[model samples]
Target: MPAKAGAVTMQQVAECAGVSMMTVSRVLNDDARVRESTRIKVMRAVAALGYRPNISARSLAGARSYLLGLLYANPSAAYISELLIGALKSCRAAGYHLVVESCDMEEAAIGEQMLALAKESRLDGLILPPPLCESAPLMAALEAARIPYVRIAPFTRLDAAPYVCIDDAAAARDITARLIALGHRRIGFIKGHPNQGASRLRLQGFQDAMQAAGLRSARRDICQGYFSYKSGLRCAEKLLNRADRPTAIFASNDDMAAAVYAVAHRHGLDIPQDLSVVGFDDTLIATTLWPPLTTVRQPIAAIAGAAVELLTTNRRAAAVLRQPAAPRRLLDYAIVERQSTAPPTTPD
Candidate 1:
């Protein structure tokens, strides 16, 4: 349906339904007292008349803004876009809107910013992801303000708080375990920026997998790189050009992993046969790369959807409600074994 210019009003739906404005309001609010027959009439009229309620007006009337504020610190364009799609879809479905704000990872006043957002008369709740969750001062400020929120990633100390995120370490472990099972003993790891909690968790997972396999991940086998294709290529060069090169490489995210492919190709190494590469975050780049990347899928949509729901859901302002039951949610992730991984070839 096309969105009409200017604001859509509820009074029109009331007039079209041949009912008092109160009746339309009651129906829209899902007031249980309204007769089912009346609701059906109002809904039918609503559909026919292209009725869209002005959320701003509703906020003024009910003292609820129905606005979800999304706070992000990640720099990856792909990650940001995916989260936006998920959050917006859920917000629209639930008759709410969103406000997005980006923050630099190193900012010291994240807590102050979050406090200001919560104090805003129009903001209902917040959806915090990554570094924000790990930020003690920021978390403390939000909790002090008693602003209802859902973290997109889990926190070690905030077990009681609602969150929607994937098992980052477990997913990374699974991906690494796959390479190990493929007989690639020497695996190189390309890390994302250290500021991201996902990067830390993923690196830990890789180490755990190697440890479980009775192997040690040496510092020489791992090179640091930010979550970028260029960084991946640079790190790959460092790892692959060595006299004793690892048989496989694992990147923290797909962008970096794709860079590894480019570097390997330039070095005259064939994917899977001479070297196998893997990555985390099975983004669109995973498929776009020459050989589809073997990576862990982060269920961006599901996590964003849950965050929006948690942020927009109503709760009493006075009551510290039992953290809204995490929307029976799980971050969907899978190891997409694509063209990027295989058994290592015997040294010629």
Candidate 2:
């Protein structure tokens, strides 16, 4: 229907439905006071007329912009893509429009930029994805503007906002333990960006698994990665170039794992033959890479959908907006075994 029926009006819809204009307004705002039968009738008329509400007029009438903001600065393109997919789907279903803004977390003026964006958009609510979700300044700015927001995968200040996430530490532990069970002792570890809370938790999970298996040593192989393709390339190069290179590598995310595959290929090392590799975030790179990737599946899209639901379904009371019920929703995670990993080949 032209993607949007911006030309249709509520007056036309009301006329078609044989209802009062006020009744149409009530149905549009989702007021429970409206009878369910009446709502259905109005919806039928709306569909028949291809009616679309004028968001600006609706705002002036009911003090609701009906626009939700999605702000993200995550390093993984695959992760961001997933977030967008889930959020956009939810927003459309809720009769709300989605506005996306990409901000650079590295920028010093993040708070000012975010505030400016909010002021410009007059958003009804916001959905924040990781790293951005933990930014104290940005959160404060949102509070100053009094905009309700939901966080996706925020680790710190769990009570500060409504959020959705899985047990990162446990997920990491499971994957690491799986590698240990595969008979790999000298497994390389590549960490994600320091800005993200999941990075630390995943690392701890890895360490905990190693300690439990008696694989911990005074010396170990680990590298820092920023969860970016470039950072993954850099970290993989450093880890692979070492003389006492690890028999296996576990990157914090799939992008880095893909990078390991590239680096191993350049060094003439065969997969699982010379080095076994694994990664987290079962993102697109997991299946696209050669031999695929054994990784942890984090439900990036479902988390995003949950965040949008929290933002839309909540009542507008000041207290309700300030403190959402069911503040933190923990979802499920799984270890997806692909072809990227195997037992370390017997030393020649």
Candidate 3:
């Protein structure tokens, strides 16, 4: 124990415990197949020796690669950027390296591309973000290859794999209700990309809130969007061009909400006074508008970090032990208020 800690090796631990290196490996992996007495002895020796295994050394001592992989094909740059920040921090802390790959969604078979990425990189595990997380082909490929992965926010198959996510529908409902509470009856909503599962939940949240308020969300008030700035611009134009425009708009994310701000300006509409706007994913874009936006915070970075930790630590094994279904970690969401939303003004 007085040793530098770094110099201790698995062999030293095994010898001190009077057991074979294989026994020590089984204990560390929590294989469950190892004898209780042997496992206890190996653990004590490991503690007494202060032996810390390097990534490569740890991999050699067990069946793990000690290398984690993350793949994403997200249209929202802000979300992906936050995801990387969190994932990288956790990987560094866990003494593991992250291999981030961007799969070509346009490829004929996304599953094949994922398979290539896994084999080419020798991934021990994977962390998948939106779009990629919901890819059936990718998930099937990983399962067939026996590579364990954790998803961020999957639309379906809640039991398919370990994951980290916020309650998208609940958060959306809260944000939408916030708009309604402000006495705005005609609130427009911009939907995100249909491909991303969270988008649907957010839209449902909006609809649920509107229905609860005894307000009918006219079809004209709901516009289609793709979670992109350009898409927001077009959708906003279509929704705001009419003389009977809504008094408020709730965008699925801050990026599109910012686009709504731009359209309001061109149309000579005054924020809060003439229009109220809200958004989701309390990313930085939420604050850049003239009157900062009120949005739902998704904790993108925290979700990413948790996903990495789950894969690198024993949590992944615990989840596997929960057989027939994967373990899921649900994080909290918050509604942030700013200058962008207020009670609608009365007409002269």
Candidate 4:
């Protein structure tokens, strides 16, 4: 009888590829010294056998878990869902598993717990999204633990730190300018929680755009929000209830934008007719609503994918790095204009 359909091993892979186990290992570990032809042959063998590396055995042999711990915070369902999809897809492609841990921003003990988690997992690297990335204690602990980590959105001024993110400030500024081009002089703004770096960057972008338009004093016109639909609704209510409402409202994210829609509905306002709204981070909620959001696309998948790529590839840092310190690559973002935004209308 033929060999069992499912039974496969590295030995078989080596034999099939006509390469030694050491060669196979080198290819799997992404050793650059290996010839491209040899790497392709080994990869073909790997595909043929449908062999999944024994992570545990590899970890024991290499003293590295080959696992990435992703620490994140955000209650937005759309944001979390998109982030997870991108992260898991990247991890799967790179032959690594992602361990996700949702953190509460208010918890003071989170830094200690995360450090303990990293130490115990023996993870090859870790991924942190803001505002945890901004936390001094968390940074100190990770530095002490000597675990390589990539910051998804850092609060500190970035100077070649390993990270993956869209240009939040630039995106926000672009969107705000778009609203101004649409003849919206009175634009209402809602900011995300101050703890998140993206939130701060986005707010700064709005301010920059307003200042460029000679609307610097418009800071008083913006309301603060926590990136939640409920927070969006409350702020939207406040803005609309005011004696002089903005012609257009800009929410830092899609969740808040949805809230603006709800509040507008409550006041019998016609979307794009009576009011126009724009949001950032073009997540699922952007389209699910009646008039899809005209917002800046965050490239969630690409960002998370890049983060995983950096983490997995860093596994070979010792061999790959010629210098003690290296710079990280950053990704770009785009503006996705949907139906929710339109030119301002004549006064009623």
Which candidate number has the best TM-score?
4
Question: lDDT of all the models against the reference?
Answer: 0.79, 0.84, 0.84, 0.81
| Candidate 2 Cα errors over 4 Å, as ranges | 1-57, 217-220, 317-320, 324-326
Error of 3 at 178 (Å): 1.2
lDDT of 3 by residue, 77-107 (tens): 8988999999999887666789988876666
Q: How many pairs of residues collide in each model?
A: 0, 0, 0, 0
- Look at candidate 1 and tell me the lDDT of residue 270: 95
lDDT of 4 by residue, 1-348 (tens): 324334778889899999999999888877768898998999888887777777777777776677888888776778778878988999877778888888876788877888888878777777777666777777677766667777776757545357777788999999999988888888899999878888889988998998898875365578989889999988999999977888899999999999999999999998988899999888888899888889898888778888888777765535212225544656778898788878878642
TM-scores, each model vs. reference: 0.82, 0.85, 0.85, 0.89
The model with the greater lDDT, 3 or 4, is 3
Local error of candidate 2 at residue 210 (angstroms): 1.0
Error of 1 at 347 (Å): 6.2
The lowest-lDDT stretch of 10 consecutive residues in candidate 4 is 317-326
- Model 3 clash pairs? none
Q: For model 1, how does the per-residue alpha-carbon lDDT over 1-348 read when each residue is reduced to its tens digit?
A: 533633446787788778998988877765667787988899887766666677778877775687888888875678778899999999886678988988765778879877786687457788877767677777778777777777776535354567778888899899999988888789999888776677888889999999999988999988888786777878999999998899999999888888888888999999988899888877889999878888898888778898776555435222122454434346678988889888888631
